[model samples]
Target: MNKTISIIGSGFSALSASCYLAKAGHKVSIYEKNDAVGGRARQLIKDGFTFDIGPSWYWMPDVFEKFFNDFGKSTSDYYQLDKLSPAYKIFFSDDVITIGDHMDQICEEFERIEKGSSKPLRAFIARAQEHYDIAINKVVLKPGISPFELVTKETVTRIDRFFKTISTEVRKKFKNPKLISTLEFPVLFLGAKPSQTPSFYSFMNFADFGLGTWHPKGGMYEIIKAMKTLALSLGV
Candidate 1:
């Protein structure tokens, strides 16, 4: 049955929901409190310079590809994406750490910080990759209507991860303060301290070094614009 649906925001998640709902034969309308529809992913322009107000890095390209593929389109149809080499640099008082685009380079960088650290880094990322598979492919797909949605053969085996903190996990393997800080940095994106964030979220590390970072031709706003365009095409 077709029904009129009003969404409260025009963020990426809201816009995505509106598109899916509209495609399912519903009338969807998005309301944005801000002047633009990108929500936190909005752009800021000053003089002749443009800046992405939020979420500058483009990780998990597969997820973005999956979203676009559902609409019979590809990301290239909307914006060009380029992978970043030496993805980013971390600055400390007396030292600097550069995160490379791939695991090999990242491993080498880790070795420079602490001898024999790359071996453990590889093992750590290997576990993170497994978590990535389960979290992204299985856990995220669940409807989240019940806690039982998280109970599965894969999750059952790794129940300890949910109880452990990323800080603990990183500290257990790495002794250098700089190296520990570097490993735990990724989970900060979850808006939680490393000591509070679950070790399971180390999958973020895999998302970083495994998938590599990317950027759109213009800015991160291009993705929002693309999603908005897709939503409108679906009659949202």
Candidate 2:
């Protein structure tokens, strides 16, 4: 059934929601406070260089693929992704570590730095993947209307795993301060200190060091262009 839906923002979330809603036969219109769309994903042009002011990193390819797959398309149809080599550079005090392109190489590097640490790193990654799986599949996808919305028995059991601070959990696993700091740096990108962000966010490290980073061929702004085309194709 086609229903009228009014989305109040022009951010990626709003644009993505509009695309899927429109694809599902909803009459969708997006109202934005800003003159241009893309909200935080807004584009900035300077000195012949363009930048996506926010979310420049395309971290979770699988999530994007699943969203595109929902509309009977793959991400490749909209944009090509080139995996970043060395993934990203990490700075720790006076030391620099460039995380490599492959998971086995990353693990080898981790083990080389801190002996007997690879197993814990693997375990941490496994738990982080579990958190990501649960978050996208069961929690984040839902509109949390209340605390009760997340209080099922399964969620109750799993809640403790996410309750600890990422810093605390990472410290509990890795004894090397530099390695711990390198792993925790990305947590700051979540808009919170590691001590405040939930441990589930370690999945970022899973996506970062494990899954690797990617960029659209043209530029990050290309994502906005692709999304605009997608929204227009869905009849706005």
Alpha carbon lDDT of each predicted model:
0.92, 0.81
Q: Against the correct fold, how does model 2 do in TM-score?
A: 0.88
> Candidate 2 lDDT, tens digit per residue, 132-231?
7766677766777876766656567877766788999989999998788877877766787998888877777777776788998976766766777788
- State the lDDT at 120 in candidate 2: 90
As a whole number from 0 to 100, the lDDT of residue 47 in candidate 2 is: 100
What TM value does model 1 have?
Answer: 0.96
Q: Quote the RMSD, in angstroms, for model 2.
A: 2.3
